[model samples]
Target: MDHAPQLIQERSAPPATLVIFGASGDLTRRKLLPAVDNLARHGRLPDQFALVGVARTPMSDEQFAESALGGKSLLDKRQLAGGVRYVAGGYDDPETYKRLAETLDELDAVRGTSGNRLFYLSTPAGAFEPVINGLAGAGLNQATETSFARLVIEKPYGRDLATARELDGVVHGAFEEHQVFRIDHYLGKDTVQNVLALRFANSIFQPIWDRSWIDHVQITVAETLGVGTRGGFYEGAGAMRDIVQNHVLQVLALALMEPPVSFEGENLRNEKVKLLQAIRLPTDRDVSEAAVRGQYTRGGTREELMAGYREEVGVDPLSRTETYAAMRLNVDNWRWAGVPFYVRTGKRLPARLTEVALQFQRPPHLPIPADQLTELDADALILRIQPNEGISLRFGAKVPGHSFRVRTASMNFSYDQTFVEESPEAYERLLLDALIGDASLFIRSDEVQQSWRIVDPIIEHWERDRSPIPSYEAASWGPTDADRLIGRNGRKWRNAS
Candidate 1:
């Protein structure tokens, strides 16, 4: 059997018109445009392709194309003359939608492009409903005999379960289930997909990837930047809603999911939703003991100094937002029962990183020295999701020139060293996936509701109590309580790079 790691399989590109709702927004210019450019550069787009950028501001197609493709690298830029256009309209403005609908025809006439359109809801959450209604009103959401129409929504699906359900109603009213792409970019990451490959592609891991051999799992996404320019947005959406609700939860589900019947896209997503559903809600006692919410205060480490969240632009001075959250979660099923899954995510910490650590159970038969137990920590399977995308395994190894002293050493599988190519960014991957009608990376409607159900109670508890969220230093892991929450279990977060 070949023990080689595999890359995400590339498939045929579909010819479709791409539309961006918030064309002037940062996400559109920074991610959407660049991703499209990359797709074009890779020769993945069809000759009949077109892009329609819709926003509240009116700008010429040349102006909009220049704005969208302005700072993109040369490798990402491609020739798309007469293949892109801009349609200015408010999210709730019916007239704007009509104009955009008309522009689709104009693009088709000029480029012989099909009527196929993928509408990316690049606008903020508040505008989601209005845009959906606007599409419906403008008759742009209909699937004609000649073409397909798809709607792609950005993350932060909702503030809670109720809002999510409400948003679901608004979106479902305008488009069918398959046409609505609820994208969670994390799923598009080459490394995230590799999690499946690392387990299934290798025979060494599957048999031992259970509660019997695995001690605990930790998924962390730490960011060094504070609220910054997104203070207004971050204030309303703390770390929990902003990151954990979708990104962290998706990562957790992927980590905990059982091996799917097949490695196909939808099959993987079906398994993911099941794993997510298996997560037991935090009880009152669990919340009191296992959950931690923290805010970053004014302090500095030896390396760098930083301001508190309140000091950021657009943030309320008396902001009650949480920059850090740590919780002990569990899957009530037999596979993960009794094994605590510790998940922590934060902003304005020591670094910007994302990783999933699977700590395997200690050896049932220990022949090593008793004093070396700390060094004999569980065999660890570490998958770095960002900074460096790779997999590392840690196991007990004999110390150099020593008696029987054993230490853990990492055997790594670095993607860059092996593949020698940059993994396409998440947006590019997801965009290409959407164009090909792959709904695997996007969230299923039910999955969105289930995530909200799990998080709804925590939000309710925080709202009712108005408790004082603990503060941590700018360049520290998090509050002291967050450490203790894990320490009491006799386990600590591994020192990660």
Candidate 2:
């Protein structure tokens, strides 16, 4: 018999003031504000909480609140909107820091926030150092005897290994490692978090999760939209830095990490760091064979004509930047010593999808005749991360009736159908976690450097090679070279079409 789901109550976050660095930007409106509103609706916010917005745009407190609310009524319209305050100033200006410090002190006294603060760096990557230094110079980085202070940084953490290390130094200088929260929204997704629960919370799958039973693992994050107006940023980042380095690699670490002693912040983060460190760093020759890069060209229906990446506004007419990337990574560890993990991400693909798939080895002996079992294939377990969040298992099943024939069949689980409540947005979970001082889903400094180390060789090799990169049609899967990358190992990418 089926049982009703248990309801777990979450504690409200302690009183604090959330100071957003890029409060005037699109991300603040589209994601940050909406997330905070959602948290209030869910009763996850404290009565003494306050919000402060800091940006160069000049606006009064009332004006900032109006702009943030966007003419929509919120669950806690009075508390949410009335608590907002704004400070307009340049990130690098010490005067700006002076105003910010004064604003924070006023809020702490008026709102009973107790000096607790969560500084969110929603600004561009270039502004990180200035913001960190600004907070320190203003004495905002220190926690009082009865209070706490923390920093939440957005990604594109660094362009490469050396830069990542340099940025780490700057951040560490102002904030201790424990007070820093390096956020990747992908880690906050319910589906992504379920990966750990699916393996550790369940005993049925743990014993066979290693090299002996699993043939390979595939992690994909695909997007159907082109660069649009962000072509300038895309050129500098490309697929590797923008997606693979942080999102894709973080998901891979979570899916493969050994079980933590407990799901606490330190234990979970330590396991992920170890898993990332185990990823084998590819060599010059390995990069040539295992990494494939491609750009998207003009190809779509006549009614919906698409422009090639090179033709996008702000992009070089002959840009060599990659819109697509696929790679085969090997983890040199005891459990996964001989297993391969394939990862790929791209823009202008067939669909917007993100998933992790594990293919199990075929049965040693199928007693059925080969011809009758022609439809049989290796079993697979797929964890879908977006679009349609779910888990699916594919295995052989008897084709009804005569001849003992078999074919692939699936058993599925959908979050929408199974859960009574809707899952919160990624930003909501991340923000709340940061406020409550939980770093389990946040990335650690060692994890960032180690991930960069794994992909640095391939990025360097690509930069040195000036040859034209392969191109795929706008509505297609990817370049033919990507197929050959996995084909060399007698495997193929999962057909998401």
Candidate 3:
């Protein structure tokens, strides 16, 4: 096994034309184009880079460019205007793809791109297959030895294991495993990458990273707002499919994956795949014991009333969809055999934060008197992923007094305070990685299936049971059962505040 890590080169990708399938969509305007602009501003974009927008709506290249980057400075607008071109056509039409292929070829000739291409499927999930098949039918899936072609598929890969596998099969028909990039923007966060750096780059933590010293790991991705205008989409996704399956699980893999021999794309991804496969998948009975699901109810004063999940604009009156979910998972492996991994995510919570906290076991012998230990907490290391980006270590310390009264004190390191430069947004880093052919931050097909495999049974159990879904208040952490899920194990969930 190769374990030698390789240094990533800080170089721009060769000239390529990035084709976004849903160019007229909200994501294109809000995230995609802005990310590209940021990369260009940083001098990271290839000199001959180009963008081709494809969508059903008919618009001229100038109109599409304006819609995507309209508010930019004069210089940026001029530079973007020349590289951006639009092709208006339906996703299912073969002729549309033919025109798209011709457009790419023309861009290659005019822009000196040398036929390199990246196809980004920003369209709805339903359009994924048709778009993939359309590209394969148009002979755009394969690249010559000197050139390359890659595809970036956005999330909600499938509803469940079977569907995920089917989607994988469909994707493979057009692009090889190496040619596909399954993007999860969470993996691009500076704090997330910091997890790997903090682990593998340091000697102090690795020796205690496994079962002997660590008691449990908690991963939380919380949101304080309701579904809002996305209630229709939320009805089908909920917290499990939306947050847990993709985002939370991926974070878990990062926290738990063994150090790879190399940071090469395949080597790093292999360890993550192993971590997911080693998850002690929950049985039907295990689901009832280890998992808790809930939806948020109304809260706040009359003038500031909030709506419940069912009361959301597009939700069903009696929807069983879970807006909040918590689970206790165990990984059956040598390094983490007895350790538990607790993950929870929800909307309308007390705050919007994403974090991972590792609670270490108490010392074998507490020299302090039992009375003096009342105020002390177990040693903890927290990796804060959002809102405030930082790492904090909590340890017991003596209160300033004659008596040895103990209380926890935090030693903190914050990205904002410690660094002079602002970290780029997640989308910006992910887009640049895709452009440069770095698959390290993206999920692979097998990793997706493995995650779904762990959650599918729990989803099934939740569906079969007729019991009413639990509820929490709009601004609370989650359902009380989530407390019990960990409390039963003589532990408790960490507070985001």
Candidate 4:
């Protein structure tokens, strides 16, 4: 007798049609389709399912599907076998969406989806309004007893607070707040979820989690590759909006949030919102003191490989775009009042990594001699989110030698070392959540707006000042000032740590 859960066997109530508005775009080919396919391959997707892709290109459904999914032979063979429906035309044209709604209907005719649909806004930021309007104008949002229409939007949700709020208004015109899913892919990481497990599930860490015991928290997301093809997008977005406003801040929230009452979507999101709200928005002086923005010039480890930001294709010759950003923020609450949470992210750095390092201060006074205790350092609890996935705790213990001295040691738990089979990729996990109707990892609209609110003033400060924002080597962590941004305060960047 099979004992697997019924939900694992039965198709979810969600109408299983994934309608991609910009199916031909880079994200669809590189990320969305693959993520959806991974869900299907792992049996996380419902059996009655269809993917309807919308685009401006001149291609038949077969061509669209083939171009996007067919070229994915380089990926796991099983995942590439998933099928999808593709519909192409200008989203600006209402007739295109009329045709897309018809395609959803046709798929429903056979699959018994009963008008249920998940609309993915994979198009450009400019197209968000038109596409959203087109869907409603085409009656795609019409409610029925059995049919559910949900919207899943890609990020760069907006460039600033006003724009993000305006975009939310536009999306809300077609779908209610409950129907909207604003995904921040960083939240999908296995290690990001593990952060909660490490803190809440285990009793060992929480006791030392408060300001009295913890010194500081460092959340960093670094990338080794420069903006290549997305220079057009990166030039305007910059590192702050690209990483911090959404990804890095979300990571920070995961690291700093109070234990959720439960793991349900709304319950978890409530804690995240609270953590974000607790963060004191930077004052002008705070901006001047706590923030540093930088760009990359023509220096890298390989002399022949140097390429400045301006020299990159699709970038302005005098672009003030910042590829690197670092900031020190204080959450204005009793738990983290005195502790500064340092955040940083950048492109074309030494390597690609995302980590949260919680540094614990040294003992108030070591009874042992300075020479004897010199080997002991501040304890750091590190959760590496990528490149390698693991948790390490640095603590002091008695040295093996007869002499009475303390030495730092690392207690390590690596995902690879423990798991026999593959860990589900972040995309795969996130796609499954969408299928199961979970938003624990997805940002709420208010969260998105608040993030933009916290970030917009920094954008304003840069626009008005227009200083050179300093440039660093392509392969370096960031500009020299970034080092002093942390070091002057007796702290150091984790790359150095």
Best by TM-score: 2
Between candidates 1 and 3, which one is better according to TM-score? 3
C-alpha lDDT of all candidate models, in order: 0.84, 0.92, 0.91, 0.82
Off by over 4 Å in 4: 1-15, 68-83, 302-304
- TM per candidate comes to 0.94, 0.97, 0.97, 0.93
**lDDT for model 1:** 0.84
lDDT of 1 by residue, 1-497 (tens): 88889888667466668888898988987788888888877777887788888888879899987886677642444557667789876788788988888888887777776788889999889999999999899898999877889999998898889889889999999898888889988898999988878888989888888889888999999988887788888888888898888999998988788888886667987888888889989865568676789988887854666788778899888878888998888898878898898889998788788999999887778876698656766788999998788988999888887577788788998888999777898999999888888887888898898888777777677766676778898878898898898888799986554
What is the clash count for each candidate, in the order shown? 0, 0, 3, 0
Q: In model 1, which residue pairs have backbone atoms overlapping below 3 Å?
A: none
Q: How does model 1 score by TM-score?
A: 0.94
Off by over 4 Å in 2: 1-7
Highest-scoring model, lDDT: 2
lDDT of 2 by residue, 1-497 (tens): 99999998776789999999999998999999998888888889888889899999999999998887765555637666457899999999999999989888888888888999999999999999999999999999998778899999998889998999999999999999999999999998999999998999999999989999999999999999999999999999999999999999999988899999999999998999999989998999889888999999998899998999999999999899999999999999999999989999988999999999999999988788888888877899999999799999999999999778999999999999999988889999999999999999999999999989988899999999988899999989999999999888799999687
Candidate 4 residue lDDT tens string, 1-497: 98867663533335477788877778877788777766666566655777777888778766776775675642343432343566777878988887887787788887756677888888788898898898899988765776677788888898898888899889888888888888878788788888999989889888889999999999889988889889998977999999999998898888888988899999988988899889888877678678899999877656458798889999999899999999988898878999988899988888889899999977887788889877777899999998679989999999888888888899999999998966676766766677667778888988987788788877788878866778898888899888888887798887842
